[model samples]
Every structure is written in structure tokens, then in C-alpha cells.
Target: MNPTASSGRSPWPYPGPRPGDDDPAGGGQTIADVGEFELIDLVTKGLTENDQVELGPGDDAAIVRTRDGRTLCSVDILIEGVHFRRDWSSAMDIGRKAVAVNVSDIEAMGARPIGIVMGFSAPGDLSLTWVRYFIQGVREECDRAGVSLIGGDITKARDITISVTILGDVGPEGPVLRSGARPGDLVALKGRVGWAAAGLAALSRGFRTPKAVVEAQQVPQPPYGAGLEAARAGATAMIDVSDGLLGDLGHIAQRSHVTIDVHRSALGMPEPIRAVGQATGIDPYVYLLTGGEDHALAATFPPGALPEGWTVIGTVGESSTPGSWAVTVDGRPWEGRQGYDHFH
Candidate 1:
């Protein structure tokens, strides 16, 4: 029998409205009313255990079954005001975005994500209905990625803060590193790049008619299985494109001791992105080059080894001189900002 049930507490701590319930405004019971323990019960209840989870929540720690002896781990933190705005995104969107961004890091290493543990802190006045929907989003993303929600911790804070740590395995091929790109490798991309940035621009101007771009900003759609496929196809190096394309590629260039040059022609501007750029009087290339949070996969592959769904965008070359630019567009240095800066 479950210890929680034996203690005479209701199995479902949150007996209030669920995701699609009429309480879309989330006006009912607040976190302060439910308290901490019961809130934990609400978050952990009915989590689906996968084959990789040897032990899940209720234990001091989770035991995850890794195929290879090695494990890959990555963490990402999202603060309310800094990383998200409640008015712009729902609790569910925020939850899904948190999981997607973290999982992309694992995939970037050419590994399979197995499980995740989250640390969530929110103000006491936050509604329990919001919490329920947020957990639902987390669970939905975990299911989509075929990973398990093993465990997590919750606490009270002035603002909502989400910290997620994802665990992955690289199998026998071993994890791909950012330092593996060679001078002769081909640079490729395997996901959307500028859609989120365009979406953000739309929302900032108080117009959300373009539903596609708007939704892209709220919940990123990362190419999940492409990382392992690229690894299997003999990718030299890879990275998750969370902080713009050129900026992220710069990391690979610096670590791999190679210079990367992106061809502008290869990155054809999508119609929607162009429309956003036109309306805002901003160059579309700016979004593709310096916008962040797309969570796309960028990698280098040997000649003729490119996998399906990956578009070759650039070429790796020897660094010409010390302190030379790591990444360039159409053989020239990018004029303005490189990517997002937390402080700037």
C-alpha cells in the first residue's frame, strides 16, 4: 500500500480543476493554501516510469539504468522575469519549454535522454491550477522525448524559477564533443532557427496574429532524434542552437581550433520570418544569425556523410590568425551583436 494513502491523506492532493477545466484563468486554490508536501504530491502523482528508471520518486534518490557505463548530464535554469513572462506564456508552455531546452543539451552531445529531475520554486500566491497544468506540460514533453520524470524538489520563492537537469547516455559510439570539428568538415543544421525570435518580436509589439511564430516563441519544437542520427552518421562535432546560430557555432570553432564560414544563401529566409522582419523594419538575417532559444542542432560531418534532414550551411576551415573571428558570414565578420547576453 502507498505510504501517502496509509497516512489517510487523499491520493490526489490537487482535487481542483485540471488542464482543460473551465478555470483557464487559474483563479482557484493557491499554493499557499495547499502548502509544500501536498504540492509535491500533486506534482509527482501518476508519473509514468520508463525502462530506464530503476527507482523513481519517494526514494531519497532515483536509480537510472544506463546502457553504457558513462552518463551525460546537463542543467538549465529559467527565471520568471529573465527567461519567461507569465502574460506571454501559460504555465503549460513554460513547463514544456523548460524540458525542451534542457533535453536539447543532451541531444547536442549525441546521446539519448533517459530522465530528468526538476527544481521548481514559485510564489505562494500562485494558483494550484497553474501548477497542475505546468506539471502536465512537463509530463507531456517527457513522454514525447521518451524520457522519464524521475524526481524533483519544490520550494517557495518570490518569483517562479525552474531548474532542470537531464541525464543521458551516449551508447557505444561515445558522446560527441564540441572540439571534434576538423578544418575540412561540413557544417550543417537540423532544425528551425529564427522562428522564436520572430515570434518574440511579434509579441513585443502587442500583435499575435501570426500564430505559428508566436507559438514557436512560447514552446520550441526541437528536432529530438536527429542528434543520435547525426552521431551514428559520423558527425565530427555538434551543439544545441539555444543562443543563435553563429554564436553557437563560434563555440565549436573555438574549441575545435577551426574557423567556420556560413553561406547566407544556404539559409534561405522563411516566408513568415521575412514578413516579421518587414513589419518590424529589421533584417531577417539578424534573427537567423543572432536570435536565441531555437534549440536547433548544428553539427559538422565529413564530406558526403551528411544525414537526411540536415542542411549544409557552412564549411570548417583552419583559423588564419590568432584572435581571428571564430565564425563569419559569407566570408565577412558579422557587424552587430553575436547573440543573447544575460547581462546585456
Candidate 2:
């Protein structure tokens, strides 16, 4: 069962039709049929091992090198039914999402991801076909980000959960932190906001949301390569909009002791999101201000110095009010929910 790269036997056919595509009825082959080792071999096939990977997969641990002699790392975990539901997302979406979220964290630090390692816990009875597609999803995402999946572990569990850890390089400029924002800095963002939340809301309410909205909810596309560009352009502070714009920005406010004032007029909700709000009778602003899991990068930069593909949303100012820091809309404190919290 210990199938290695040199084993000379491939468990499944790749570069062909995807799993279950041949048998749309999903003929009964489960993970038990393929076993863990064979599953590993199938997934690891064709994965590019970059020069940074001193020791790639098939080993107990992987060794990755950083160009700057310093490394930045971040981890994110997605549990079935908590972060996503299989009924709502395809295996490909789930896999891509798992990596995208982790990559977003590395991007938030203004770093370029070099390697990724994943740990998958799944039910032994799960379909082998499904598992293969999931791995394809993971591999595809890694390729999209120009990084390699160095190594990972698979095991049996009650439910599917993916733990992804990404390693990144910050180069000479250094990693961006949430604490660097200062008064007079411009608050800006790259990529969409509130679309995921709006899509999630539609799914919850059983509303037939737009295809774009649904895709946004299931598979997020973080502005790749923009983080490093921002850092190179002298971005003071940065964060990924994972748990809503205000909530994520609040992290910067708290860390840097600055108040961020968002100009609502300038932060217009996209047409798709506005349409969702109109259909659902929900305020688009609610989604824009408090929605989460968008994976967009929100940053603060000097006036007139915002990087390309970034939109100015607000301005940072000295925190002269109560609490450690604050966020306001048009100079007024927001009274609604700031962002998502795991616990109430």
C-alpha cells in the first residue's frame, strides 16, 4: 500500500476524463478500494517540485528553502459542514477553496507563496472518485498560484476536514503586518467584497442566486501577485477580507491604534451584489460592510499611491475615540455587526 513515485504502478488514469465522468452513475468504488497509499500516488503525480523544495513528498517531512533567509507561514482549516457543505460545493470548489484561503493569509502578509502542505481527514467510506477529484482540485489551485504541494498526510475521520499550511517568501521589503497603518493613510481593497456572503445568504434561503454569485461563494479568487506588488509599492498595512471588511480592518485598527473611516459612497456594492440584495430584501450594505470570506486584500497606502487593481475605500485617521481603535462610515461609528465571529 506504500505507493511511491518510483513504484512503476499508477492506481488511476490521469490526463483523461475526471473521476465519475466515465461513470455518471458513480459505480461503487470507495476509498477503501484504492487505499491511502495509492490515493497519494494518484494525487502527487505531475505535481511540480520547485527548486525551493529541497525534499519533496514521499518523505515524512518536506524541506523548503526561502530566498531571503526568512520565511512566512500561515495555516487555515476547513471542516465540512462548518466552513462549507459538500451539498453546496463540488469537490473541485472545496479543494480550491481550501488552498485559496490559506494562500490569502500568505498574501495578506505581502509575501509570495512558495510551498503548500495539506492534511486531509476523511471518512474511509468516501468515494474514491470523489477523493481523486478533490486532490485534482488541490493540485490545480497550487498550480494556479505558482507553488508546489510539497507534502501532506491523509487519515480517516468522522467528517472531511482539510488543514492547509502555506510557506511564503517576503523578499527584502519584509512582511506586511496589520499594525503598520497610520493616520492619513488611504484604505483600499483589491478584489470583490460581500459577494460570497450574499451568495451564502442565497443558498441559505434557497434562493436561486446568480451564477457569478454562487461561484463567488463556492470558489474565491484572491488577487494573486497583488500582495507582493503592494508591498513593493510601500503598502503600510494589509489584511485579507476573510471575515468581512470591517472585521478584518478592525484587526488593523486594533494593531496600529488607528481609526479607519470608510466612505460608503465610494464603496459601492457591485451590481451583482446589489441585485442579490434587491431580490432578497436585504441591504447590500450589510453584505458589503459585514460579509466575510471574500479573501480580498484590504490595505492602507499613502494618498495617491494605491497600487493598480486596488480601489480606494476609506482613509485612516488617529484613534481619538473610546476603545482600542475604531472604524467608521462617513465619520460615524457603525452600529451594526462589525464582522463574523466564531462565537457570539
Global lDDT of each candidate: 0.86, 0.84
Off-target runs (Cα >4 Å) in candidate 2 are 1-26, 321-323
Clashes of each: 0, 2
Relative to the true structure, candidate 1 reaches a TM of 0.92
Task: Summing lDDT over every window of 10 consecutive residues in candidate 2, give the lowest-scoring window.
Answer: 1-10
Q: Write the per-residue lDDT of candidate 1 for residues 253-332, one digit (tens) a residue.
A: 99898999999999999888888899899999999888888899999999999999999999999988863538999999
lDDT of 1 at 270: 88
Lowest lDDT sum, 10 consecutive residues, model 1, at 1-10
TM-score of each model, in listed order: 0.92, 0.91
Flag clash pairs in model 2: 242-293, 244-292
Which portions of model 1 show Cα errors greater than 4 Å?
A: 1-27, 322-325
lDDT of 2 by residue, 110-225 (tens): 99888898899899888876776678788888888878898899898999989999998888775989999989999999988898998888777765356577679988989988
